[model samples]
Target chain A: MKHNFGAGPGILPQEVLKQAAAGVLDFNGIGLSILEISHRSPEFEGVLNEAVKLVKEELGVPEGYSVLFLQGGASTQFAMVPYNLLPEGGKAAYVESGVWANKALKEAKYFGDVEVIATAKDKNFTYIPKDFTVPADAAYLHLTSNNTIYGTQLQEFPASPIPVVCDMSSDIFSRKVNVADFGLIYAGAQKNMGPAGTTLVIVKDELLGKADRKIPSMFNYQAQIDGGSMYNTPPVFAIYVSMLTLRWLKAKGGVEAIQKENEEKARVLYEEIDRNPLFKGVCVPEDRSHMNVCFLVENPEHEKPFLKFAEERGIEGIKGHRSAGGFRASIYNALPITSVYVLVEAMQEFAEKNK
Target chain B: MKHNFGAGPGILPQEVLKQAAAGVLDFNGIGLSILEISHRSPEFEGVLNEAVKLVKEELGVPEGYSVLFLQGGASTQFAMVPYNLLPEGGKAAYVESGVWANKALKEAKYFGDVEVIATAKDKNFTYIPKDFTVPADAAYLHLTSNNTIYGTQLQEFPASPIPVVCDMSSDIFSRKVNVADFGLIYAGAQKNMGPAGTTLVIVKDELLGKADRKIPSMFNYQAQIDGGSMYNTPPVFAIYVSMLTLRWLKAKGGVEAIQKENEEKARVLYEEIDRNPLFKGVCVPEDRSHMNVCFLVENPEHEKPFLKFAEERGIEGIKGHRSAGGFRASIYNALPITSVYVLVEAMQEFAEKNK
Candidate 1:
């Protein structure tokens, strides 16, 4: 019983792993291995179709929206959002909060004029800015829904005058969302869904083809939507595994149930960190991410010892990202509640031992 | 014992499949599965480093070349090549021969001035045009090393005035080549190497940073190279499978031995097609691809019967692409000599029954 609290390359359910492992050898009793199957083959086409269908069904995607499975993860989508929607010489509004948000803004600058509406960079990205104005003239208001490195999430997606484009990379599929609220939303599959390979881009149909630039076919959301994400050979195995994970999500009662479990897990960890004498929570309580719980150990010496304790206890991937030090426990959708309790136990045990 | 002749998501060695499936469960005895492990983890980094090292070693890559594993298939690279290599307002030369070649040329037009030095469109893409003269002032001379759909291969790369950029997507790693001859070479790993998510790019380091436009980080080869393909979460599973396949290729004595075996397989099948009274070879003998072997049946009615015959004999994915009719059997690196014999026998039986 290992407790893995990894960041994206999402921690998957063990059963999903077993099924994925089985698929590598023979998928659904097909004589050929999934790893060797051609993307154009009927078998893989079925996998692609089912994955698209499940994501739409689970998300309650509206009639006009198209759910596409694309490549290059959230980073690609960062640039692709502007490339597909921002007309030449147009301007888009952006709210920067974390590394990914800044990266998105930087990429957008290449396509068109970008208006920086607001940024939490001044405060080192510890909190989500609630009062940012989106200019009506801007093509779109781009923001990161969840900041993984900063351990923050935009709890309430404030109404924007322009169309909303959200990079929900680390927190998508963990909660229910209003599909109509955003013009486009992209999530790297690794965090809430599957492994690293495909990015799920849900875009409103009417918003496409407005951009004047010659968008690369791979980054052109319209082309991908028209091609059913099979414009080229898709990341077949990754999509298959994503389909399985989505199936698991549906079977466990969809996003609502998963969201409830997620809240409880976060509450337990955050509450423990608040009550425990040896640690301090990093993010502001209101904006703290349920997915990534960042905290610092009191006394720099305890940091090393506690990490060692967790390591010996078989708790993996708790190490914080390089930019944001201390520790980060990314309790994503597939992470079990039991893992949280185990991590809390490690924290308590370490404090007792050192005290 | 399925005779898989699929045109991509490269056919894996039996041992490679078993090992890959096992890695999905427990990678190197690390309690975490490969799919769940973070891309930044030491284990995954090892996989990435080894994959790069093996590819470079096998290709005998020159000292200054940078090998990168990236997401988005060859189609993404179609535009990314010009977006990175061709400076703003500069012209690049291209040889258009097959379906992929036409697509590449079309995409390159968006990035800069594309001069089609020669095209085989007049012949319905049946042959490679060797009479084209590349302009001395062109940024690069881009060409497809092998045409998968038309079954045509460039038997010898002609001297180019400008730097050569080769799209070796369909035939990379199948044969040895002088890496110094090309300024850049990119292959979608699905064909001769890994699965369908990642692309392998080998570029001359000196040629990077010359593009006048600001490239999106995901599409920017220099950024990806500097970051070791971890500029973002790479397709972890794809790279791992690629590494396993690369290891298998190395164990099989690398490219030289595989090339000999590939030659024998192609020769046996080509000879059978040529000798058979009921069939005709499509590609010119001198420019025939060892990877993709296409042919035509004497009687158009036999197409269906032949397809059914191949299916019954457990030969999957032998059906021809829609654009190119009749039949196509892609004997990639992993396709065994025995599979070719089996296919030849099936062809012989079909002709005998039809005749």
Candidate 2:
């Protein structure tokens, strides 16, 4: 079996894939493919409802928040967040942790004044900037919870006076976060949740309708909330697969239990990276992401050979991003501990040969 | 043997569904689920490239046009069209043919001045408004090619001095269109193309970057074209299924062949509707939609029983929209003429029982 370590559109539980495939043929034994049913049909309404309920239960989401399974990925949310929250001429604070954060801030600039409270760009985003001040005058403070490109994560959320809009696209549901702490949380489903089409948004109800901008119906969170996420023809198949994935997550003891497994997966893999004489971790020890572990070979020449060596042993998508030329084994929530062990073994064997 | 008449997320070709299911489990022998693979991966890039190429080939898109597979459906395009084409303080002329066209024009108001040059609302959208003049000063004239809810379609497109933007959500590839006649044509894939998550946009490349407003990257057609519709992680599974459906279409002799089949399907169903003493067509004869055939019971009491009668024969989703208050058989591109025969047979049986 191939061990997938792709970052974003990463690994999913095998059972989820099985069920999703089954649904594509005949959904819930209804003699209809899930892709063929109307969004307004009771069958699909049930799927969407159950998915939302699972999200609430899995995250222990407090009331007064709306959970939406919307089309477009986190990239859409980058603009939508500001469109709904930032008023004309209002300033929004941003903490640039990595490339994704930089993109988010750039989108926010189109809507209003943007204040870069902290940035790690000077050091090529190797570490998450910790000493950042969130201005109360700003409409909201945006943060990237996990950096997929550089393998950096905010270990602790910064306490902010204003509402916090966090992009947790890479690490959502891999660990627990108090739902009450943030005004808005959006994540593309490709990472820990499900697939690439749908985005999961948990927005504080009171945080909307304050921007005073003429928001389009699709981009308006309030409109989506009012319509129960069926404001228009939603990404039906994407939502269905996401619902199945979430069901799998729920069956496996939810986020809390998955967190322990994810931590162990990252720990064992990172431990091997440090212990191996030929390998080295990329990010600072304190900020290295549990979701994506970035590392490199001591001798740059070993990179190509090590990648091929890992691929031979059925390891896939371990090659790092182009911006950061190294290996990034994204051990997302669905990645089994066995896959990590296999990668570690491959690394150890490769180091032995190289030395 | 289910005859899916659902108005989107409508029926897909059975073969396409099977292929999509297989891809969900293991895409192209890659041993990784399509949902789990990276969108940037060569495998997925191939799928996306083929999808674009198929669209260009099927639609006979010209050199100046770009085919985009975007998320957020037609509703998002309602805003994006105006955001990209209509400049601030400019006016967009709209032919308010149906509810969808009305909604599209409403969204345009958020960006600039809107002129409702023609509307068939007085007749409850039972006919397409034909006598509308396109103002030369208007940025663009928007029209809905097929009205799904009302079962009305523009049999002939209006001659426009300005660029014409059309929403073909319900009837995109059901027939052939002169691509050069329109500036932009968009369709939610759930109808004639593939499934719900992705939308197909064929836009004139020269028409973009004309609006003097700050269009967000996700909504900006220029940015999407620049990124090759990979401005962000696209709806991968949706696009994959769409490509498969398009491939199926091409193998069936492309749009020209499908259009003939669609014409036959509409003709047989409408003939049965008109001949049956208990049923009556909803829209004006010349304006009836080929994609969605809406009709009503002559005696109002027959409506529920007819729906139940159809359902018993394994005919699903034939229930008309609530606003229309009748029955609608959405014979989209994927629907076989045999399914139309079944529905017609059911109608004949129902009328015989009533008589």
Candidate 3:
């Protein structure tokens, strides 16, 4: 009955974990472990196919887009996005909202010129930077939808003149997005999806082949699309587990249904953080991420005590990132609202004890 | 009762599978699934550390080398190798032993000049080319230690004036090799190591940083070494299973013991292939792989019937690659000699029935 709140490589549905465990022993009664089967095998091909289909169905992805399951997490995408989309000597616009965004822009610099059109770095990224112009001359505008460390999110995507490449690593599928709005959306599966091996890349088919750089087969979005994400041996088991998780999401009535649950979970948790005198929210109210609710204790001494208290109550991974030193309760799609209730109860109990 | 002989994402030890399943359910009694735990958690860090240590110990990797568990399989490494090693306008030599080697060379061309010094393509890669001079002027020489599709392996590593980078994907832990001989050795963890998703890179420290190109952090060996293969969220579960498999290998008396067993397995299977009137070995006798035993039906009509007969006895994944038509029984490290005996018995019985 432990509540998992770790950010990225975060919580997954219990049933998905059980099915994944069972598959590791005997996948679909084939007497073969999922970990031992060939990716070319019909069984694994089916898993990869279903996983891609679920991503499309869950996100309502338009037909003109390609959904890819690739390796190397979102960090790899920081380089890949520019490598594929940004042409030689072309510039890409970036909004540096957090550490990840800063890293993304830095990687983009290796390929071509980068313009930091907007950033919330001044306030330590406590709010998403909204007032910025999308440089039309730029090849693309790169954005981080949710800053996991800073607990801020782009509440609404800005209408851009050029292609928008968003790193939705932390908050994908927690809410619905118009697939047609962005040229590309990449998310590491560790958060709100499944595990840590595979990355989900949804790219507009037309946005590719414009970079004019000689891209390696693995890094080329078109190459991956042409191979149907099997250009080489894919991260098989991770894709399989992700398929299981997506199946669980579909069974729970898809992304729209889960989005409501996520909103409610964040609502209650944030409400508790606000009402309790000992705790305070970390980010601006409007920009606060529903996926990760970052907060701080008013009395710094209460931080250690509250963490231990939460742990005793089966609350785990609530500790904030070292960069943002307080607490962060990540309410991913798989994290049940009941777990949020438990956290709320613990917070209240701790507040009462301190008083 | 089933014998898995898939080329890769191949068989893992049953005990390793069981433990992996248990860990997926509740990793180390931590009340969290291994898939759900943070990569930075002490638990997973311990797992990653032990995996690196085990790779070093099992391979007798000298202190000057680094062991990296990366993602995107060997295909990714094809580009990464050249990206990190081949400097701007520098020449690298490659041996085109098989399809994989051809692909590796193709990737190298993207970075700099790639010279194919030796090739077995004339014989459909039926043998390993032995006589080739290592060009002293080249930055490094690339070689494929074993060709999975062609069933040919380099029985002896060639002495080189420059550095040697080898793709040992299919035969890494099946036998021991001197780490000092190579500048870089990378293998996708599917054949002899673990499942698909992770790649093992063992590189001599002195070979890095000479490539005077703006190498992205993920592809740069120096950055990866600095981060200790945690440059990004590595293929966590894949690395975990690999560690478990390596641990299993160590307990089974490490690579030296496995080599003898692998040799015996290959000996008996190849002996059966030679003895059977209906079957014939695919590659040259001197160069046949101990890991992937490829053979052809003397009568083309016998191929399907022989496959069915083998399948009836619960023999799996023995079908040859489409390019090389016949059968391929991959006797990887985790595959027991008993499984080889089962495959050999099936071949004998099939031949008797045909006779």
Candidate 4:
């Protein structure tokens, strides 16, 4: 069997995928396919509420936070954040790290003034910006927790009096986090959750309804929370699959256990890259992402050959994103540490042959 | 087997559901579940393009129209319509037919002035408003083709000088339309298409980017079209199921054939409701929906007994919406004539025993 390393729509726990597949065929002994069931039905209502409860329990979410399963990915969240928080004549702070961070800042521009607190773009986004201060009067501070493309992650977080917003699209549920430390956290479910259709949002209740602009009902967190994310027909199948994965995570000892396993997977891959004569890790050591480990061949001429070598040995989607063109092996929470060892073996064989 | 007749998330063809369920397990012979694959991959890109092509071909969509599979539901489209087409200081006329039409108007109010040209609420939304003149200066005349809650439908569409926008959430793909006549058409994919999670949007290319306000990237039609609906990771499972359903429709002789069968089903059911001594049709006869067939027991006391009887015979979700309570059997595109016959038989038996 091949190992998958594609970013965003990354790996899922095998058992969760199987259960989700079975659910699509027949949900909870119901003769109808999950895809064909009514969202307003009592069966689906239970599924929705249970999924929300699982996220809250797993995250150890403090009181007064609304957990919602919304559609439209983190990219949509980029614009929606400002639309609901950055009112007219207001200013928000954004940390420009990767391409996604820049995109978020660009969309935020339409709603209000965006202050560039820090940016790592000057160095091809190879490292996270460390020394920067968020404006005291800013509405909220926005940052991407992990830069998927460039293999960089924020090693140090800035403490701000203003509400903090984070796009944890690539790194959510992989580790233990203080849920109350941020005002809002958003993640597209494709990465570590289950699939691509659902998006997770955990927001502090008091921080909403303060925008000066008229927000669309779907984009308004207050509206969604009031409606229990059923203001309109939700992405039910996606949410159902997510619920299954959340259950799997709980069965495997939650985020703290997953975090330890994820660290070992990253350590093995990063160690192999450092030891191999023909390869080197892409990002600075201090800021490397455990979820997505990116590396490159020492000699540019060896890049194609090394990629081919990895591909022939049952590895897929190991090719790096075009913007950052070396190689990326996304070892997400569900991807086992043994796959990392296999990938490391491939790299060592390639290095020996080339030498 | 029980036949489903829920309003929003209605029935889908059994074969389509089976194939879609299989897709959740394995896609295009690939071991990876469709949910586990990357949206940017060639496999999914083909699926998205083919789905769009099938929609255009099936609907006979005009050359300048753009088809987009978006996340969020038609409720999102309600606000997005005005944000993309209705400029600041401009007005748009609306035919307030039922609950959905009024909701559309409520969202549009946030962007510009909304003119309710006519409303059917005077009669508790039991009939379509026949005499209404859309203003020539209005940005667009918006209407909901089928009213799910109140069982009313617009039989006679107004020929307006202004542009026309339609919310075809419940009726899309069930009948052929002159695609070029309307500037935009939006539908939540749960009814006639496939499942929830994806919303289909068909907009005339030239009608976009004319709004005065800065549109959010996710809601902006032009940006979404340019991105080929990959502005962010799409609802892959939803779009894939919709594609399968669209293909099934084409295989079964497209919308013309489906509409013919739909008419016969409605005729058969409406005839039973009229001929039976204990039952009566709900909406005004002329504007009764061919898709959703609504009826009521002549004696209100008979309602509970008939519903319980139907339930015992494996007919679920036949109860009317809470707002208009009698009975609503939604015979959407995928529901069969045989199912309608079964429902008719149930009604006749109830009438025989009750009388």
Q: Write the per-residue lDDT of candidate 3 for residues A36-99, one digit (tens) a residue.
A: 9999999998999899999999999998999999999998999999999999989999999999
Candidate 3: tens digits of C-alpha lDDT, residues B256-326: 99999999999999999888888999999999999999999999998888899999999999999989979
DockQ, structure candidate 2: 0.90
lDDT score, candidate 3, position B95: 97
Candidate 2 TM-score restricted to chain A: 0.99
- For every prediction, compared with the true complex, DockQ reads 0.84, 0.90, 0.90, 0.76
What does candidate 1's lDDT look like per residue over A1-355, in tens digits? 6788887786898899999999999888987788889888788888888898999889999899999999998888888999999999999999998999999999999899998889888888999987877899999999899999979998989898889999998999888889899999999999888998988999999999888777778778888888989899899999999999999999999999999999999999999999999999888889999999999998888888889899898898888888989999999998899999999999998889888
Model 1 regions more than 4 Å off: none
Better of 1 and 2 by TM-score: 2
| Backbone clash numbers for all candidates listed | 1, 0, 0, 0
Off by over 4 Å in 2: none
Docking outcome class, model 1: high
Worst ten-residue run, lDDT, model 2 chain B?
B207-216
Clashes by residue pair, model 3: none
Residue A165 in model 2: shift from native, Å?
A: 0.8
Report the Cα lDDT for candidate 2.
Answer: 0.93
Query: Using alpha carbons, what is the TM-score of model 1?
Result: 0.99
Candidate 1 per-residue lDDT over residues B1-355, each given as its tens digit: 6898888775888888899899989999988899999888889989999999999999999899999999888898899999998999999999998989889988998888999999988988888899978899999999999999889998899898788999999999999889999999999998889888999999999998987778888888889988988998899999999999999999999999999999999999999999998889897789899999999998898888889998898887877789998789999999999999999999999888877
lDDT of candidate model 3 versus the reference: 0.93
